[model samples]
Target chain A: MKGRILEVARRIFGQYGFHGTTTRMIAQEVGIDISTLYYHWGEKGDLYEAVVLDIYEDLREQLFEVEKRIHGLPLDKRMEIAVEMMTDYLFERPEISNLTLFRYFAKTRHASPLDFRVPEIMGNIAHSMGLVSDKKQLPPDAKMKMLAVMNAIHNFVSGQNFFLTMLDMDEKEYVKGVKETLKFLIIPAFVHNGATTKRA
Target chain B: MKGRILEVARRIFGQYGFHGTTTRMIAQEVGIDISTLYYHWGEKGDLYEAVVLDIYEDLREQLFEVEKRIHGLPLDKRMEIAVEMMTDYLFERPEISNLTLFRYFAKTRHASPLDFRVPEIMGNIAHSMGLVSDKKQLPPDAKMKMLAVMNAIHNFVSGQNFFLTMLDMDEKEYVKGVKETLKFLIIPAFVHNGATTKRA
Candidate 1:
């Protein structure tokens, strides 16, 4: 029942957002009483936080695993692996992408607990891809370039259903096109730039 | 009063989405009676449609004007002007960006009324940039590449507040960075590629 509640909560929160969702709604969806939800998650805030953290942690783990697998490849190859892994992960679990955007808008007035951790995680991944080196802070231009790449991939995966429908294309074809476009955009933006050339 | 209702409706609908908001809420926000809202806009759906159409018309006019201003420029220069104009428009009026994404998710089951019109407008703009010659259908690869570029710029503008906060950067500095990054990504992807090389 506890696990079931979390699963339902994730979907509900992703759809309706924090303010739009209620504990009662989550309890009803989970086929449990309100008290049972509180017993497991403590409060509405707690439940929301748990769902966001779980999604982030899962993504962090996946990125780390990809990093490990591509540890010694050339920079271009490493980026290819990272983009492929990320695109697949995001496509399969679009709720994470939606939830990330939801949290961004919903909590902009206050600092997000995940704010510091996200840059760190993304920084580490970029380091592994040889876009950044150890013992130095990421420069502004590099940061903007990486952010653009991340935004492109994030929107592409999240907006897949919309774009596929808008463009009247098949799923297989659209995904293939996305991969090709990413290769064209990411390689020149990150790898070919003189500042972040592939490391030896 | 009718114009006031539409303006308020645009902001509220953009923030809360179609279902998330209510006519009563708009009435209260606009400081008018419920009957007044009904008098101006027949129903919630009618009001929503009006908002969507108004936004699309405004964007169309802006794009056309940009086409006029950049007439006869090099393909790269023309693209730079179009992107800069779009980035400024979206950033200043983020509600359009939010509402665009909202409509995508909210109405994916059916074809949007703007479906045919949007492509024609974008195609015209692309033609003006010399991406496609007159009296030719946009090829699939070029279409996908343009869509990717559009998505990147849209997401970058829409996610501005979230990203500025996340990166802890100044607003002016961030917007400038976005333009530079767009130039880096857009030039190589669209202009330097063999298929869409500038016309003689």
Candidate 2:
């Protein structure tokens, strides 16, 4: 019962966001009493915190798997795998992008304990991709580069309806194209950067 | 009075989005009565539509100027100038991205006459960048490429708060870094593509 509630909460929060969603809505969707939801989750913010943490954990897991595979590959190869793996993970659960984008643009951010942990995650990615030597003090350029990669993935997922219509593509083609385009655009640049740095 | 109200509406709508925003809020911010606001624009949706149209017009004007300047330039050079100019334009008025993202993710998209005109815009842009020759029946790949570029720019602007915090970059640095990063990633990929096609 607890697991099911959490799953529903994740989807609902992703759809309407924290402000747009109400405990009543979640409970109604779960076909349970609102008080029952409170009994399990405590409060709306608490449930939201759980959802954010869940997403973070999932992202970390995906990053770990990606890191394990691309640990010692060339920079371009690492980026190719990372972009493919991350885009796949995010696309499967696009709610993650939806919720994150909502959090960014939300007018009044609800007070919550769990946040995106963006820097920590970016640091891990920068280090893993061989862009930064230290996660503790990632360079602005490295972080910025990671930002470019991440922003592309998140936007492609979040803006699906708009992008699909604009591109006249089905969902399947959109996914394939997103991965191809990211590689075509990102890999060579970073590979060139890697080469330039080695020469420098 | 009407013009002032539209300006206020654009900002508020960008901030709170269409669903989250209300005529009352706009009136409050504009320091006018609700009746006065309605007198200028029929209702909430009417004013929102006006704002969308206004943004589209601004984009068209910018595109025309971009075309005039980069008409006969190389594809890579065209992309560089376009990215620089468009990023500058969008950053100055981020509400355009905000509202567009909002509209895409918006549940129960409000009924409005003025729409994004995404295909038309993309075709014009793709042609200008030498990705496609026709504004009509844009090839799937061509549209996808344009989507990649547009998605990168929109995400960078829309996710500014989240991205800036993660990157630990000041606003000025963030803007400069974004432009640089886009050029670094996009210019080379397209340039290579252009070069390959020329050889073929």
Candidate 3:
């Protein structure tokens, strides 16, 4: 029951955002009494935070698996695999994408607890891409370059529907095109151009 | 006063989204009575649509300026100038960026009245980039590649604060890095590599 409530809460939060979503709506959707819902999750804020954290942790695990699988590949090959994996993951679970965009526009004045987890996940991916060393330290220049690459892929996947409508392409063709374009952009910047390795 | 309402509506709507904002709030913020606000813009929906249209028109004007400025330049130089102009423009007027993310996540069930304007804007950009000729018809492959590039830049600038926080950099440094990285990625894909002009 708790798991089911969390699942529904995530979808609602992803779609409607914190201000737009109400505890009553979530409880009604879950077919539970308001008090019962509060019993499991203390407040609306607590439930929203849980939903956000749940999404991040799931994404982190998927990224970790990608890192593990691509452990010893060369830089170019690793990037290809990472981009492919991330694109598939994002499209399949579009709620993450929606939540990401929601978080951006919602503009909550305080920092989210989930916010800190992003850099750690990015650091793991950056290390896998050879943009940072095993020490997980990125110099200023490499940090910026890696962050740019990350932003491109993140936005490409999150903004999929908008792009699909804008470009007027079917899903299969759009996904394939994104993969190719991402590779074209990223490989040149990070691998062939050697921008990642150049120190600040 | 009507213009002031529209401007305030754009910022508020961009930040809070449609459901999160109320007509009363907009009216109060504009320091006008509710009837006066309704007189200028008939309903909440009307006001929201006006705000959205206003944003797109402003952006369209900016893009037109870029197109005019970059005329007669070689393809690579044109791309560099366009990316720089766009990045700076988005970062400065981040309301457009926020509204864009809002529209994506909001997922209105019907086709937006504003949907048609996107392709028209993209067509103009494609012509300027030489991805489409004066004929203004894009091959399917060119269309996809061009859209992917557009998405990348759109996301990069819109997702700026999120990326800035994730990468733990000051805003000035982050924007500069994005400009450089966008050029590095876009130049290779569109101009040097000939990805755009290569037919489907």
Candidate 4:
């Protein structure tokens, strides 16, 4: 019943958005009473947090697996593995991805508290980048660049329609755009500037 | 009176979203009768469309200026220009940016027609890329990737609170992230693959 409530809640949140959605509506959608939801998750926002946490856990597991798989690979290959993992993970769960990405942007309004795990994930990526690049005194600009790229990748695969419209790209072409964008936009700024070695 | 109505409509629509906001409320907010809105915008949906169109026009004009200014620059320089324009555009109009971006991802149970000039903008960028790249067979995935990057840039520059919390990045870091992200994540895939130069 708990899992079922969450599933229904996910769909409700995805469709109606946070404010537009409500506990009673979710209960009705799931064929349960409003009391049942309160029993399970306490409040609507609580339920939202639960749903978001569930999605974040699943994504974290996927990222961890990708990181494990890419161990000992060449730099480029590792990057590709990371890209593929990130893309596939996001694409597979586009709705949840949208929720997360949107939540990230919406945080500026202090509309809601941010997910606690976001910082952890960003920190992990930053640490990884630091290890890859041995250069001391990395310019202030380099960090900004890294965050921007990560944000871009996150928004792209999260199923936000902004990019699709902006590019006027068909679905297949959209995927291809990701690959090309990764190569051209991400590499020159990060790989050489970011990496300890600048082979390319 | 017409301008006042539009402003009230923007406020209500932004705060309550499409389904949550209504014409009656907008009229009340404007201290006028609901019928006054009808006189100005013809209908509720039309009012909504006008608000959205206003944003589209403003964004298009800003971006167009950036495009023109950087027309003669190299890809790197052009990317820099894009980053700056996007950053400035989103920050300058945080409310409109938030509403438009939120609307971009809002899901409808039914297929709905999309408005806004985002599609045209996306196509313009893709066409520009096509002109620069000789690749005959640009895949859908590639296009999507481009979309993702663009969305990222948009989302990042908007300086939404959620992003600040999740990434632990301030405005300076956020901009840096955008640049680094473009360099590391985007440049590599496009440049190394030589997809840009590949002839059809």
- Cα-based RMSD of candidate 4: 4.8
Residue B58, model 3, lDDT: 84
Shift in Å, residue A103, candidate 1? 3.1
Each candidate's DockQ score against the native complex? Answer: 0.38, 0.57, 0.48, 0.41
Candidate 1 collision pairs: none
Worst 10 residues of 4 chain B by lDDT: B129-138
* Per-residue C-alpha lDDT of model 2 across residues B43-106, encoded as one tens digit per residue: 7888888898888778777877777778888778889999998899899888888877776665
Best lDDT among the predictions, by candidate number: 2
Best by DockQ: 2
lDDT by residue for model 3 (B127-171), tens: 666566642566556665565566666676767766777667788
User: Against the true structure, candidate 3 has what lDDT?
Assistant: 0.74
Arranged by TM-score with the best first, the candidates are 2, 3, 1, 4
* Reference-based TM-score, model 1: 0.86
Residues A101-154, model 2: lDDT tens digits: 776766643344455677778777776666766678877876777777877788
Q: On a 0 to 100 scale, what is the lDDT of residue B42 in model 1?
A: 95
Full candidate order by DockQ, most accurate first:
2, 3, 4, 1
Error of 3 at A161 (Å): 3.4
Q: What are the runs in model 4 whose C-alpha is more than 4 Å off?
A: A107-115, A127-150, A160-180, A197-200, B7-16, B19-39, B42-44, B109-112, B116-119, B126-146, B165-200
Query: Model 3, residue B4: displacement in angstroms?
Result: 0.5
| Model 3 regions lying over 4 Å from their true place | A108-115, A195-200, B108-114, B195-200
